[model samples]
Target chain A: MTSSTTESEFGESRESDSDNPSVTKVARSKLSIALAAVFCLSVIMGTGPGVLLVNRPESISGIPLVYAWGILWYFVQVAVVIVASLTVWRSTGVAESCRTHNAPSRPERNSAERGEGELPR
Target chain B: MTIPILVVLIYLGVLLLFGWLGYRRGERSEEDYYLAGRGQGWFISAMTIMATFFSSFALLGAPGMVYREGLVFALVSLNVPIAGVAIYLLGNPIRRAGKRGGYITQADMLCDHYGDGVGLRLLVALVGFLFAIPYVMMQLKAGGELAAVLFSGYDHAFEAGAIVLSVITALYIMIGGMRSVAWTDALQCALLVMGMALGGISLVVSMGGPSAFLHEVNQLPTSSLTVPGNTGFWQLPMLFTVCLLMPIGGIIQPAQWMRFYSARDADTLRRSALIFSVLLTGCFIFAIMPIGLGGQVMYPLELSADGVAPNERVGSFDQILVVMLDDLMPRLLGEVAGATLSSLVIVAIMAAAMSTADSNLHALSALFTRDIYSRFLRRGCSEREKLWSGQLLIFVATAFSLVLVLIGSRPESSLSGLMQMIVTLALFAVAFSIQLLPMTLDVLFIGRGTRNAAIISLSCGLLVAFCFTPLFPLLFAKESSPLILWINAAKELIPMHASAWGLVVNGLVFVAVSVIESRVLKARSV
Candidate 1:
């Protein structure tokens, strides 16, 4: 299953080398690792022990202290997601080309990748 | 009859116009109708996504909760940001898969990944329907409640309002489907934000300024300003459970899942996450929080003799913002201007409800058409037959929802009890939606689970979730099942939400079942 499926199977053509399945796989795996790390960090900061940091009885700038703390993290998350989307998710020339071309050749590629229209067993 | 009613009428007219426009642009193809040809830009996608996510719950329910519970409800608002993160982490990959697979619904990708087992497709469709109907009902109830208050003098106003809103919403979606839904949602999102900001600002100015508002809030009891909050319902354990699970559930629900499939590319969704996070946080803090805290000051909680504060509630907690808008806008702006602004706020409330309802209804239609009807009722139906079937289901769902809303609007209906029941059902829907998460993770990112594992794990997870719900108790003869005692014990021990508890079982069963199935398959191959 692992060999059969790779990030290249999902139309993420980074480095203009979508033709090279091996390179696309390596890039996608690295992107996956980076996303995983960010996700873990968000979980920690947004909900886990990070919640403890805001579970308090105070106020800042007239807002409840805890609410103020939560808002700060909210901004941090917004920054992080924007950074990730611009950088890690679309990090190559092929991605740039795909966007520019509006992915005109997507339907044929998608059908080939998905193997739809199969007879029901 | 009134200014607010007129404003709402005008708003409805604009929505119809958008529907007509969408109808003009729509093609006969399924993808064109369901996903707007998957060419949405960042702004439209962001606004539509945000609009669909907010619902009447954000506009009406959250502030009311804050009024009842205090700042802890504000903490719960942080869940919006977590959902934004989910959009980035979960949605981006899903979009990639969607693009690769030409997927239109949650079941489409899942059935493709696991091979089209009829049972798997049906289960996914059932979950989507169950999750969607309550949400549609919630928004319908909201519309009725808005009408009930805004046109208090008229008899049967609530039912009339609910029926009207339902018909109009269903009509628009029927006219142009997802295109009309998304385009109208973008406009509704803008109005929602502005309305919230206007309400907050109106209150602040009426009370002097932000500092004065804060000073008033500071004068309130210390309990209202801290964790554990008003009646102690926002205790850490419950808060932790809600903050963790509900956001993820909110994001991964069927409507949102389809939104992931509709994105033009990763950049559109990425930009959407950024916009959504900022807009929600701003509206939550600067707009929503003030109405709640201001309500506490305006209508202080009633106390008992012992002063234990048995419940964190006020007579009309849910109506605080609406009531405040009615009162403050008039005093602050005077006659014509005040009435106009109030009318706009009322329209905004309607927008909030309608945006959520349309998305849920649209997703439900797609789920029925693609997953169930095509699979069983008519396997080789033309695109026209499928489209018409999906369109018919919208009215079916809406009519059923309207009947429930009317029944709940009766004088004998316990408004508080009904609200509580609706809330519980809605939460239960989310719990069921979250069960799809493990399977989704497996299909999109991790390719480990087998077909049998997906089917069994989903069944077990949904069953466990149902058992943990409050509905489980009602199912018994005396409303006191054996499960009640165990649920009570579990709550006493951990104070966790049913969604959280269900998820523990869900993950464990999913991983365990997958391992067993995988081992069996390996042995068979050997």
Candidate 2:
């Protein structure tokens, strides 16, 4: 059962890679890693908008300069969406799917004996 | 009774219908009772994840925080991507471990490694329930207040709210169980997002457009948006801490872990985490910041006979959003919108609270039945009896929280203050189990440490967190000055902004004890 699954998975990967050119389902670069790092840093280095407020301390009439804090903040938000979309989009089955290929003999047999196993769901 | 009553009843009745449908599958086996028979798919997992993630804390607390703090409060949410990554990193392995062991709680993963029997699992689950009750009460508090506020000038509004919310939630939870919670969450989440957007728009429009509101608010001293005192005194360290650690605290949450257990595979968990990350990001960034900013712009002052600014309530920041609703929305539409928003906020909060609560309650019950009860009370009891014990525990836990709610009500304290105090109990409780952080890292990568060592480290970590709570106060009093205390106290007292130095202490002890255990094991082996 496990061997047959691997053969099919290999078959699927070959068929898909030939058909689709835009799918690279893994984070495999200094650039990608750097971008991921930068994204994470902005979140962790949550220095208040004070520094930004200092640079643009003057709000005209009633508008707080921080109102457009979105310009900075949303960029970070979109950056995350970009990275996430990239990661999931690329790795449809590339890095290695979770292991479900073993001949379920050991677990099924063991549980049958214990009366506690229900096929590991 | 009224159209509003009909809407609420239909809403709740539909929920019961869903729950009944789910219960139709049967719950005779442990598979059905605990993990939804482990048949949950990507969509259910995602919906459950979103619902639980976007709960009352986001709905009410986000806006309330904005009311108290400024637009800056929403900044804490920026951590989601990172938190998503952290959870993706942590939750995946934990999910894998759970799939391997049929372990349902966060402590299940921990206990399996630590060999501390159920002691560690019991500790984590018990803490989860303790922290959960108050957070649940906060939702109940919001739902009840919103009901009373909407039904203003009506008799028995408060009593009506309590009855309506509790009965509705209880019926759905009891009937539908976990599946009901997840499905209702999906429908409710969609409504919640739309309602928040509409309300935000209405507030902006009613405040005389962004132009006018901004113009008026710009006239106030800059200190208005900044904290009460100047010198960036209270907030500098606060933003960094709350924004950082709370997301980290989220990683250890057993309720959140339960969502992982329900997922079909690693791929589904990954996708769900990714989707929810976006949802959570949008939620935090939009939900409260706009409300906080709106409060500043819209509700300038109450009029006096002489037309001077009357003495405004100093700390009632949460009421700003409500006031804005009254000002921006017309009498009736405002009421409907408010009611809808209230429903979303209440369910979201309750969902978050309940998802976390039920998972924790189960974990606690497991400790009694699987760990403590079976160990002592009735050895080798039938699996069916053990399952019932878990259900009984859930009822007891719900009752305990109801008691906590009654107790929480009579106390003369600020809402934000109470939220901080209660959440602190949760953070402090779980902070100890963080020994698992390093342990988790090792297991996923290095494969180090014995079960005994893990337990000792976790216990010591718990101790240090408790010690710091009292120690910090004594330390503050002896400093012969109140500046640091005042600054720290500001965060500690407010629910969203509490000082997290205890978390730091907790982390350090957990690490130290784990290291101690690791080295001791190495030496003995040599």
The C-alpha TM-scores of every prediction are 0.88, 0.79
Least accurate stretch of 10 residues (summed lDDT) in model 1 chain B?
A: B306-315
DockQ for all models: 0.24, 0.22
Q: For model 2 chain A, give the 10-residue run with minimal summed lDDT.
A: A1-10
Tens digits of lDDT, candidate 2, B1-526 = 2444566666667667876786776565655656676566667776666655454455455665554445454455565565666656666666656666676655555555544355665665555554445445554555554555556678756446544555555555555455666666666666566556665666666667768756665554454444421223236455555556556556655556666766666666666667767766775665556665666554444333453231263223334544455445544356667555544433344344344433444445544555555545788778788777766765665566555444444445332334332333333333433334555564455544455555555555455444444324443346446754554565456423332544444445555666787788789999
Question: lDDT (0-100) at residue B418 of candidate 1?
Answer: 44
> Model 1, stretches more than 4 Å misplaced?
A1-56, A60-62, A92-121, B305-315, B409-418, B421-426, B475-479
Clashes of each: 0, 15
Candidate 1 predicts chain B with a TM-score of: 0.95
Q: Which regions of candidate 2 fall more than 4 Å away from where they truly are? A: A1-32, A48-63, A88-94, A98-121, B116-118, B152-160, B213-221, B227-234, B301-316, B331-376, B412-439, B450-453, B463-500
Evaluated at residue B261, the lDDT of candidate 1 is 82
Weakest lDDT window of 10 consecutive positions for candidate 2 chain B: B225-234
